[model samples]
Target: MHYVDLDKIELKDIPKISDPDGRGNLSVVERDFLPFTIKRVYYLYDVPSSSTRGGHAHKELQQFLIALSGSFDVVLDNGKSRRTITLNKPDKGLLIPNGVWRELEDFSSGAVCLSLVSEEYNEDDYIREYEEFMLFKSS
Candidate 1:
């Protein structure tokens, strides 16, 4: 892994259009919405609040994470500095670049985490161990 600046992680408020029925808001993410073209999309739901997810770093994956339903907190580490970001609005998302370690925790009930990735699933691209991640960053 290479050194990633913590300042590069950003929370973006996607444009939301209200429903004609005055019911709810809708946000769209086309290719123009992100720096990279999205190739994979996934979501996490029905998670216990005490459970934590995402304790790894990717070699070449960029992702945009959204709170589609409730809320959660994302803790980011770049092997030098750390930061915590809260995602509660459906129209907002966090843009995470490659080489940064991310952990998701403190999920509210009925919370849904939607992730849009720049690449397809590749297990070899992920560094699942913290020590290995640290070594990669130092190299």
Candidate 2:
């Protein structure tokens, strides 16, 4: 089987149930829709100019990123192909699997990026260097 690539990043659109009163609508993300089980939820707010985040690759964890407030670009690399995705809607999210290095850059004013992580934080599970990530992906 071909290895997963960053360009293969999947986009999922969360559906909102219609309510007659239009109050308290509910949305859900099915486990089958995601590659992994979500175990954590976090968000990034107040990014400074020329600043970037998530310049690393996970070994086993998967993440779904949603732009809850404004807009931002997510750059992903999988040793061969690279893709940049723009996130601007809260109902839409990108599913990034392990072995893909991702970087969040070019944040619009008042951007809030939410992340749903499959695994808990573990420093040993992250490959921070590009070269190291490439090597790990090849092997």
Candidate 3:
């Protein structure tokens, strides 16, 4: 597998519009803000505190994840390196590129994980096993 720089994976800001006179805040994710055109949108919510999600990697799929309600931890691995990122801000998002392993854990109560996907659902694109991911990286 070609080496991927873990440092390049960082949170991106979603454009925000502030409301005057103490009302509320609004954030927008425009078409030009993201590198990939979104083809699917989904969200995870009402999760148990001890439960975890996403223990797989994608071959050609890329995703942008956001914590729209509470917070969670995303553990990312790229064969030779690993890192953990905390998603706690609604206006910030994390982009997971293809060929990287990811796991979501440590979800706070009422946490919501919203995903903007680059492709439609396809079972063949996922690498569900860690061993298989390692092998795919080497090839």
Most accurate candidate by TM-score = 3
Residue 26, model 1: lDDT of 77
lDDT of 1 by residue, 27-116 (tens): 888769999999999999999999999999999999899999999999999998999999999999999999999999999999999999
Better of 1 and 3 by TM-score: 3
Q: For candidate 2, write residues 1-139 as lDDT tens digits.
A: 1368554576789776757896855667777767678889899999964799999999988889998889999998878888899999888899888888899999989999999999888899999999998889778
**What local distance difference test score does each model get?**
0.93, 0.86, 0.95
Q: Which candidate order results from sorting by lDDT in descending order? A: 3, 1, 2
Of the pair 2 and 3, which is ahead by lDDT? 3
What range of 10 consecutive residues in model 3 has the weakest lDDT sum?
Answer: 15-24
Error of 1 at 28 (Å): 0.7
Sort by TM-score, top down from the best? 3, 1, 2
What lDDT tens digits, residue by residue, belong to model 3 across residues 27-139? 99989988899999999999887998999999999999999999999999999989999999999999999999999999999999999999999999999999999999999
Q: Score candidate 3 by lDDT.
A: 0.95
